[model samples]
Target chain A: MNYETPPLLRLCNISYSHPGTSASLLQDINFSINREHVGLIGPNGCGKTTLFQLIMGLLKPDSGTILLEGNAVTKSRDIKKLRRKLGFLFQHSDDQLFSPTVLEDVAFGPLNLGLSPDDARDVSVQTLEQLGLKDFEGRITHNLSGGEKKLVALATILAMKPQLLLLDEPSNNLDPATRERLIEILRGLDLAHIIISHDLDFLAATCTTLYTVQDGSLQRCEQKQVHSHEHIHPYGDYPHQHGT
Target chain B: MISEPFSSGSTLFHCSDARVKVIGGTVLSLVLATTTSFAVAMIGFLFTSLLLLISRPSPGLILKRIATVNIFTLFLLFSLPLTYGGADIVQLQYFQISLDGMRIACLIAIKTNGILFCFLALLATSSTVSLGHALERLRLPRKLVFLLLFSYRQLFVIHQEYLRLHRAAQLRAFTPSNSLHTYRTYSHLFGMTLVKSWNRAERVHQAMILRGFDGRLIPLKQPQLRKSDYLLLASLLLISLILAGFSLNNPV
Candidate 1:
């Protein structure tokens, strides 16, 4: 990594509120990501996903600048450039994998990058093979098993060969075996990614840095502080560790 | 779960190019629909039936589908003879049945069945994705094809969402009945499903943009038309031309 180069992504004083609402969903979110795996966690409705949407230009920030590779993203063209460098894996695999077949869905990003159909297919095939899904090319997207659909959805993003990935709940609905496979794949990837997941174990295994969004603010959480401890619930005398 | 059961096969129709099948199916159906002569209609029906047989769909499924279509025609069969006025009439005690009306109804039933069999043999043998690509290649509007392909893809998602909502309601002891409460609950369930689907659509759109999707959906593979496909197309056109000639020569 060149020290002279700027961070891969930078956000400055970012704030956002839903239209027609008084309260802000996010406020003064400042962060920068280098070539490193980052994990973002928050309680439900804490604006973690909204932060990602702002980064990806899906939703504009009310006040702030989003920088991609040292350039300010202030226009549609700049957003497009940012998008070219960033691949966002949606929370639901069903939403991400819209094409009929696995190959088509995987090829979609490459084709949009202006590759010819044959070349796009070649890249899609290579991406699938890299992810151990060589035989899934002809499988219908909707008919795929939950685990298979998740892998294929990841493949769709990976086919674009982005410099960074924004993954939202990649391991949400996976079985144990599949989740293990996902962890292995994520650990093996060389590209930087920011994963938003409630599964702390999943984040601990795959991400180098963890961040938490609370009360419309983003703060870094230390890795050493992510240990499980016995705790009692208000409704029961039994004590158990979280995520047991 | 929704599925395209007929899309997987190795028969001639299954192996044929989707564009050819689309063209052949359209021409044959148009011919069958427009023809008025019984002779042409019967020949077209036999031809489509033979195509259906060659495609090798499950006999039980084919019978069920044909029966479903014929059920509607059965209404026509019963009512047309009584309602249609003609010189040639069969007198019953309280009503008169027109022979021409009966003939025309039978012709329509034959034509409808012929078209149905033709589509099942051709269109259903290929996956809807390939069919959408074929339509695009045939110079259909790109937006229309996109609409068709997207709608087909989203139908299952929307259905699953609806089922999940319905299951949640069921878990809450909400039983659907012929009552205002049931109706209200059902409407709320449907409305929630729509809202969820709308949000999912927005997320999907964002995902697409994040992955650099432009306006066009380019297909990865462009299926090539082979000799067999050309032969199929030629034979279908020849059959259609023959049926058209028979109809023109012997008008109803």
Candidate 2:
């Protein structure tokens, strides 16, 4: 007998539309990921977030099948099981962090997973230490700077020890130094992740596979294709790369 | 901005366990509120004032807070003596002043100041999150604790949203004045803020579910009450009981 492990995540024939809308935002989308760092890039409001919501089971797809580790995620219990192995980081760190303190926020997921208070706290401390946030345990969540909040938000997910992470706009609104630090952290992580960002350079530095959502479909793009291009400006014609 | 200026100190009140402070503060406030004896109220006021001093709050801020509370008491002092009816009446220029009314208002003012001082000394020393956790440990309703924690977290977000909207209005050269246009613009700004907050709440709820959040929010670190915390609680309770006893023996 021959058998192989299935993909980490699989979406087959997925389609979704907003309520009361006739046009589908995402249509006939089929994608799969397996133990590889992936990057997803697209324009604003092109259903990138909607696709993530479907994957996280926040919104039910109009027509589709989502498989996590070869198990179909249809029922609520199945979705809960899938969530145990999948971590979704929101685009807005403010929305992702609801706890008043850093340690509490990081420990939230572990506590929800039925870990004891001591074990969850230990996990939270270790996660924060891994992220170079050792002294941030007692920091107020609302008082953190933008970059610090983003890193703390990532720690909250990392504490859960999920198999795959889905990070939405991880590099949004970060300063140059903090963005560089984030890139290094993402590259150092051993688990697989699908990062959604508008920063092409960030994607190139962190992801091994690149995908773009356009025209309601997911398409693979070559790294070589993301090169400098000439464009006409009001002042003059100039060559510039994306995300300059 | 809602600032917790007193929350970052290293005084005894700050170092004590939040649960101890919460219980002590609540008990003291209850005792003071129920007491009608002038002597008991004065003693409680002095005790709370000493506690506030030991907490080592900035002198200026503490004075400002006391001043704000006293403003309302000043109004009571001026109005109560003239309006309240009693046997001991004194004739003013155009009204009768009741000595009993004056006594009652003075008692209320003293109790109010005492409670305020107690709250500032004990409760304000801990951050709101710690207070919520302390309340949870004290067997308060889980939903109420959640509501307090979540609302405290979202207050900053909502405040920031409102500031952004106000900034946008300023960029458009909108100015406030006694005019219908200004009122309309202010209403629109408030409406937009509410709508944005509603949307953000939905997104935050989704994020919570994605993290496998069940109905309960478990606190990670449960602070143990140390010997000092126990000592402080015992002292406060003793003071409260003594004051209650004195008030019962010498009722107004």
Best by lDDT: 2
For DockQ, the strongest prediction is 2
Chain A TM-score of each model, in the order shown? 0.91, 0.91
Clashing pairs in 2: none
Model 2 spans with C-alpha error above 4 angstroms: A1-3, A116-122, A132-140, A143-145, A222-244
DockQ of prediction 1: 0.67
Task: State the lDDT of candidate 2 residue by residue for B36-90, as single tens digits.
Answer: 9999999999999999999999989989998999999999998999889889999
TM-scores, one per candidate: 0.90, 0.90
The residue pairs that clash in candidate 1, if any, are none
**Pairing residues by index, what is the TM-score of model 1?**
0.90
Q: Note the DockQ of each predicted structure.
A: 0.67, 0.70
lDDT of 2 by residue, A75-148 (tens): 99999988888889888898988777798889899999999999999999999999889989989888899999
